[model samples]
Target: MSKPGKLIQELNRMVNEQFATPEFHHFLTLPLNRDRARFFVTQSAHYIKNRRDSWGYVQGAAPLDVKAIIWKHEEDELVNDPRCNSDHYTLTVKTGESLGLKREEIDGSEPFPAGRAAFYAWLHLAKDRPWLEAFAASAILERRNNGKIVRGGSLSDRIGKKWVAELGFKWDEMPDMKIHRDADEAHSDLMEMIFNRHVKSASDEDAALRGARESLEIDRAFRGALADAMEKIS
Candidate 1:
């Protein structure tokens, strides 16, 4: 098998393994109330903003063709997507509406200290690391969200199911997550395209693995911190 194919299999394994971590396990198992749900969606809007910043930095450091691909990916994120006619951040705010969150509430949401630190860690990878590593750091997050890749379901699917079971929300009322569950399937294909085209040497594979590993670690810490904060809410 080719190096990129092997690398992709390893990355997929890494993503699935995350659900078993203490952080992911705790976060996913948390029982949801309306207040906790409100807090989660509000905080998630900040995460969406961080993704925009990191992807812009990654775009600036990438090769022209890669930059073009990132730009096209950002179109659905930064501008209007025909799928929802809302940029991703706005879509997140809209998601909050289902939890009784007003626009100002989401707009004023702040990240926990650990979550803020994790966002900065991702920024460093995107802005200062090698372009492929930076690309992998961002792409791996989408790969984690891609339902086709993650067995059972992606993060959004799991959380959305919680809303239905615990908070009485129907799947259709949570369009933002449903949209991402589909969108990431396509976005993750873009990640594989980059790897197949660029990951030719052992060092290239190392860079991708490094990014994927570190990003997932930071993601664990971030999710753990959010769970801690949510626990304090009720």
Candidate 2:
């Protein structure tokens, strides 16, 4: 098989293993309550903002061609998508409304201490690592959220369903979650294309995988922290 194909397989394996981890499963299986839902929606907006910061760092550090790719990826995120009629943060705020959250509440909320640490960890990777590693770290989150890649369902799909079943939310009501459920597939594809185009050497592949693995570890920690916070929301 081709080098990129092999690398993709390796990446897929890493993601699959991530899903199987106890921390991941614990976070996913946590019961959703109204208070928890509000907390999650509010905190996730902060999480999304952290993503914007990390991606900006990555874009600043990337090569010209990779910067172009990152810029295109940011179009649907940072800018208003004519299709959705909103950008990602706005969409999250809209989702927050369903949880009885005001835009101000979400916008003004502080990141939990653990969430703050996780965000900094991600930012460190984006800023300090090689562009390939930084790109891989950011892309792995989307790739993990790709239902086509993850067995059973993606994170967004699973969480969306939980909100519906547990919280009586309509699928259409959570625009941000629904949008990511579909959009990350295309995002993952784009990242994979970049991997294929740029990752030609063993060292490059190792760096990419290292980034993916470390990012996934941080993701698990982030989710675990969220779960802990959710449990305390009563």
Clashes of each: 0, 0
For model 1, residues 187-219, the per-residue Cα lDDT tens digits are 889998999999999999999999989999999
- Return the TM-score for candidate 1, rounded to 2 decimals: 0.98
Point to the candidate with the largest lDDT: 1
- Residues 177-211, model 2: lDDT tens digits: 89998888888998778887898899998999899
Off by over 4 Å in 2: none
Residue 222 of model 1 has an lDDT of 94
Q: What is the lDDT of candidate 2?
A: 0.89
User: What ranges in model 1 sit over 4 Å off?
Assistant: none
The whole-model lDDT of each prediction reads 0.90, 0.89
Clashes of 1: 0
| Residue pairs in clash, model 2 | none
TM-score of 2: 0.97
